[model samples]
Target: MREIREFEERLQVENTSGEIPGFLHLYTGQEAIAVGVCEHLSDIDYIGSTHRGHGHCIAKGCDLNGMMAEIYGKETGLCRGKGGSMHIADLERGMLGANAIVGGASPLAVGAALSARTLGTGGVSVAFTGDGGSNQGLVFEAMNMAVVLQLPVIFVFENNGYGEATGHDYAVGSRDIAGRAAGFGLPAVKVDGTDFFAVHEAMGTAVERARSGQGPSVIEAVAMRWRGHFEGDAMLYRAEGEVAELRANKDPLTLFLQRVEGQVLQEDIEAIDRQVAAAIDEAVERARAANPPSAEQVLTDVYVSY
Candidate 1:
């Protein structure tokens, strides 16, 4: 979680300084959702992410240096800097890229789940979407199809309150996103996304069900994003001090530390923090030093010659 936070903080700083190229959608306060759910997944289990997906990539074991380089638009990045922040994918790690379009990964996750079922791989696919994405018609279609085919898929709704600036209350028609899953005959549950244990437990159940060929499940993780929709957004739409209040008292990392206070040593935790900070520092330095993709490579990955 600390690593994820540091990654975004660095990106925000670099972006503000005009070092990072292109638009950046940061994943600042939604660490637990990725880490908690990913803890139950292996390399074989698939996960699709959103525009704000740095946390998901890291949680799924993507190389830190490569990701930082990718964000920096360097050739050493995961996609040779072509995919940038919103489209980092490592299929070997089971992360099927983070899409810029809202709810775009729903169908991708469904397809992966279907493949797993057909191949009898016993692997599950997870679609990580936002509150705004939950309203997309494509997501509903994918959910219905997963249920009908009994595919191993988990639709994880990261309800961070706003869809680019509109509040969920104004945009979402459903009272609670998970409630709508009943219409599709899937088990749906809402959990405290800030609490890692709660998310882990809920994901565990869903994973078990999916692996056993019980079809899909919907999980509404109620959390909030600490930053605006994008880095440069002024965020005038939000109520004054809302994000500040959450950062002060409701931080997921802080809550997680408090919950695990007695179980782990303070020094050990501090050591981990130092290690993560150092790693992030090294990644940033490497990304800064790395070069961008050459002109020759521009049209290389765009189309197949054959």
Candidate 2:
């Protein structure tokens, strides 16, 4: 929770700098989903992210400096600044990349899982998509393929109520996202995404199922998006007092702090907070001082032996 808060603060700083190029998506309220799922994963396990992916990157052990640099469109960024905020990637860390296209990464994750299965590697692949992407045909296709192949994959549906400005209630036809998983002939679980323990426990089961060759499972984590869909959204679509109420009552960071009160010392958590703040500060400084990509470099990577 503390780490999540720190990430949120860093995102705020990056967004406020007015230097972040292209679309910027904030994961203020959905921290638990990323942290919880990644808790059971290792560097060998692969995970795919969405546009609102900074939290996922952070949770997956992405370098804060590189992420900040990418957002700032610096030459030293993870994607050499070409990918910007929506397409950051770190193959070494098992992050395929953050897909700008909705529902784009699910099939990629399935492919990774299929490779893992065929190669007899113990690694697993996870697909992190939101409620909006869940409606896409690709998600269903990935689910069916995963189940039929019994690939080592976990489908993490981060249902944050709204798809951009549109409400999930209106966009998603189903009452329960997990119920749809049953159609794929896979076991599914629905959890409170704001509660770290709940997400952690559910993901633990899903990961185990996938790793043990029990086939793919769907985890629908019901959460709320604290910030606007993107950084500059007016959020007029949201009901009055809805966001405030969710922050006060259902914030994942707050719930995790409450649940782990005794297990983790306050001073220890505070130390992490301080460290994360310093890291973010250093990242911002580095990004600001770094140079942008050269014009010639763009054409260089576009072709093969041309």
Candidate 3:
């Protein structure tokens, strides 16, 4: 969580300082959801992410330097600086990339699950979508197909109250996103996203079910985003001081610390913090020194010869 926080803080600084070229959807407050689900996944498993995907990429073990460079549009990035912050992908790491379009990667994860089922790879795929995205027709279609095929997939809904600037209450017609999964004949569960252990335990069961060929399941993680939908967004849709209050009281990192305070030593936690901070600092330095992709390379990755 500290690593994700530091990475996003650097991006915030760079975006405001004009160091980064494009827009970014930061994964600021919803760190536990990604970490918890990904703890049970391997490189063989696939995960399709949303616009707010930095945390997912980090949790899946993508190189921090490469990801930072990708956000900076440097040639040394994961996608040769082509995909940018919203489209970063690394197939070798089973990260199917973060989609800029709302609920765009749902089918991709479903496709991956289908492929895994057909090939007998024993791999599971996860689709990470937002509350607003859960309303998208494509997500429902994907869920329906996963159920019919009994595909190895997990539909993870990170219900962070608002979709973009609109509140979920205003946008979604359903009372609970996970409840809709039952309509598709899939097991559904909801976990408190603020608590890492809760999310981890829930995801463990979901992942095992998918791997065991019990078909896809849905998990709605109730959390909140610390930032707006995108950088520079004024977030006028949210109530004044609501974000501040959540940050102070409902922060996942803080909650995690409180939960494990007696079980873990303070010095051990501090040592891990120091290590993550230094590593993130080094990644930032490397990204800063990296060169941007040349103009000639723009057409290189855009086409393929038959």
Q: Which prediction has the highest lDDT against the true structure?
A: 1
Off by over 4 Å in 2: 302-306
Clashing pairs in 1: none
**Candidate 2 residue pairs in backbone clash:** none
lDDT of 2 by residue, 1-306 (tens): 555567666767667767877877888888888999998988888999998888888888888889889889988999889888888899889999999989888999999999888898899999999999999999999999998899999999999999888898898887678897778899898999998889999999988888898989999999989888888899999999999999899988788888878999989888887887788789889999999999878765445574
Better candidate by lDDT, 1 or 2: 1
Q: What lDDT is reached at residue 40 by model 3?
A: 96
Clashing pairs in 3: none
Q: Whole-model lDDT for model 3 versus the true structure?
A: 0.91
- Put down candidate 3 lDDT per residue, 81-135, tens digits, no spaces: 9899999999999999999988988899999999998998999999999999999
- Report the Cα lDDT for residue 180, model 1: 83
Choose 1 or 3, whichever is better by lDDT.
1
lDDT of every model, 2 decimals: 0.92, 0.87, 0.91
On TM-score, the leading prediction is 1
Where model 3 places Cα greater than 4 Å from the true spot, the runs are 304-306
The reply for model 1, stretches above 4 Å from the true place, is 304-306
Superior candidate under lDDT, 2 versus 3: 3
Best to worst by lDDT, what's the order? 1, 3, 2
Model 1 over residues 221-272: C-alpha lDDT tens digits? Answer: 9999989999889999999999999999879899999999899999999999
